[model samples]
Target: MIKKMSIVCLMMLFISCVKTKEEKNFFSNGDFYIDYYENEILIRRDAFYKKGNLKAIIEFKNDKLDNAKIYNGKKLVSQYFRKNDTLYDSETYYDNGIVIGEGNVDRWCREIGWWNYYDRNRRLFQKQHYVILNNSQLSNQVLFYKNGLLDTLRSDIADIVFYKDKGGASFKGKLIYNRKLNEKSYVSILFSDSIKDDFSNMDSVKFDTITFGDKAIMEFPVIFESNGRKNIRGIVVEQYAKEENVGDKPVNMLERYMYIDKKVDFH
Candidate 1:
């Protein structure tokens, strides 16, 4: 009777394993499949196309984004990691598995710092330095040629000059506009805790009311809050008339932010 009981227990365990396997393989809503740990925490999410081709694989830890890999059929197109859902580092590959672009994206979903772009032959063709501008949808980009020279022809920024005086260090930037400006356009320079992260507590120090121009020059004196390094942010606000068919939209406002870093010089 004891031997018979042991055999029955083995059969039940085998059945349970088979059931779990079948659930993992076929339990899907037709587009994606999810797997969970024993504690019901989601471990992996596999997304598929309508024809059952795997599209993406996203992994999570503690219910937050950890890393994600996107694919085009059997080829990996891009992969990125969001540690703690804050920092984003991403890399994209060509269809032939050659790395095309790689960069870090800030919490605001804007690309920050330096980003490299490669040609199809795996050679570095260009580099871009992205900074927060007044318009959250847009970023000021400083471009570089493959030979490491500044590519001003392709860069959005014209010129930014910094200087030191008796009061403190100050900066001025020349903005070249593609179209003529009106009276509603202005540039504001502010002091902020960070140049890239958050801009809520910024203190405006200087502003320029630009009217009727293809170019605007904005400058402000820098005031260091501490002896350590700090960041300065400049915002260019451009306003346009209300467009038709846009429901209740008063004005089209576009803002961009330019970032600069300075350190206290005791000498």
Candidate 2:
């Protein structure tokens, strides 16, 4: 009986030593291990590190990766996918795990837009807009200058209305003067009249002509003199009119003319 008791004690000691050795070897190998409760329920486990960096993470079911934190070299790096293993969110970190950036995806459901960018200091710098379009070929683009200024804006729609109902239309173009009104301001008009059934062909009512000042009273005749020099001379006219649609009505008309020196400076 004494010998049998001694053999049992020795066997128990050996088993304990073997278990301790196994635990130590598990940790030394730099691979993560899972822990459990008395009822074999899972609990949280520490992530393994190799060469001062994170290697792998050991997971559990009850208190598992769903609420666990991931680490790399003692720095939190990422959070694992959910229980379904369909999605995973990962984050990059600086040396001290300062959370440089993070990204994730939903693999099971519809694709969600995702974008990320980092700055020089490992911080988020630029974020992109991701959206699904009905036609992938048609996409909106925005441009910016180097100085962060908006230079020009344009769209894929026509906004200018020049003509409608096959009739004549009017257009206005402004000439912004820099210093003085030395150059002429061009004014043009187009007209289309209905005759039998369709409208008349398009025709220009007026063309470019030089003027004085901002008002219409100071008119100048833009012509080329005998000296071959193009001169804008001030001319006065009583009235100017063209043939009207009426025949027997007799459109009343008057005419006047005033001429200015070609070399005169109206400025």
Candidate 3:
């Protein structure tokens, strides 16, 4: 019988190579969809809950978001990884899964460096420290309690403040109506060459040119020249105005950096 029809065509090619197919699609957060499995491998991307069940699964590879879990019924609570695509490594649990919080986000999604919190008896309580700078500024943040003390420091931008004059490198600053500033402003102090250098080459070193009277907090006095191997790097803010007649150019608007050894006492 032609060798039993060649053993039934090798058992139908091993049952079509173990069959597996899914193929779902459209998921730009419109409540999730993406699934694709044997069609080309997208692995997961699901979300449900309006009478259905499962809430999140995410996982993807060549498509991006590498891992995610989140659930409530079967209890996974939360999870994250995204090895690359600008960083994510997150975590969060507590629905019995414990973990509470853990972090490292970047690609403009802020939150970087140390972040840990836990309580439902896992103890550790709180601790966040995101100092970030040229990574697009989170510029400073600190908090830590649960006995480690320190508590709060946060400040993403109050527009400008500086104030340090420890008998030397000088600084006395001000500016406040920040909605990005512009009642005639232009402050500078750049000066890099490393501390992670990024202002495309940094050099300015000193500048003022203010103009916001009636006590809208204008104060200014910048004085620079600390080249004992250079270090103060950051504090720009510009925008001096001149609409249809154009003349006194300035425009840039805000840049801040500190903590490369705590320059100007940005402790």
Q: Write the per-residue lDDT of candidate 3 for residues 1-267, one digit (tens) a residue.
A: 354558779999987886467755444554445465754666676776654467788877776777777787578876777756777787878877889878876644466655788787877757654545434544343444545553334322333456667775677766443323454444333333353332322343343334443344566776554423323434434444434344676544343232322234432
Residue-pair clashes per prediction, in order, are 7, 4, 2
* Deviation in Å, model 1, residue 159 alpha carbon: 6.7
TM-score of 3: 0.32
Question: Which numbered prediction scores highest in TM-score against the true structure?
Answer: 1
Better of 1 and 3 by TM-score: 1
Name the regions of candidate 2 deviating beyond 4 angstroms: 1-32, 49-64, 81-85, 105-113, 120-123, 127-267
Off by over 4 Å in 1: 1-30, 106-114, 127-136, 142-146, 158-191, 194-225, 236-267
Clashing pairs in 2: 236-257, 236-258, 237-256, 238-256
Query: Cα RMSD (Å) between model 3 and the true structure?
Result: 19.1
Better of 1 and 2 by TM-score: 1
Regions more than 4 Å wrong, model 3: 1-35, 38-56, 70-73, 81-84, 96-99, 105-112, 121-124, 128-143, 146-267
lDDT of 3 at 35: 69
Give each model's whole-structure lDDT: 0.57, 0.36, 0.55
RMSD of each: 9.7, 27.7, 19.1
Residue-level lDDT of model 2, residues 1-267, one tens digit each, is 454568889998876664221121245666544444334454445445544455445455654455445565666665545634544455555666566555543432222233354544554544332222231211112222223333333211101111122232322222212211112322222211221111112132232334333343332222222333223222222343344548677765433332221222221
Model 1 pairs whose backbones collide: 133-256, 133-257, 134-255, 134-256, 134-257, 135-255, 135-256
Shift in Å, residue 225, candidate 1: 4.5
Q: Judged by lDDT against the true structure, how good is candidate 2?
A: 0.36
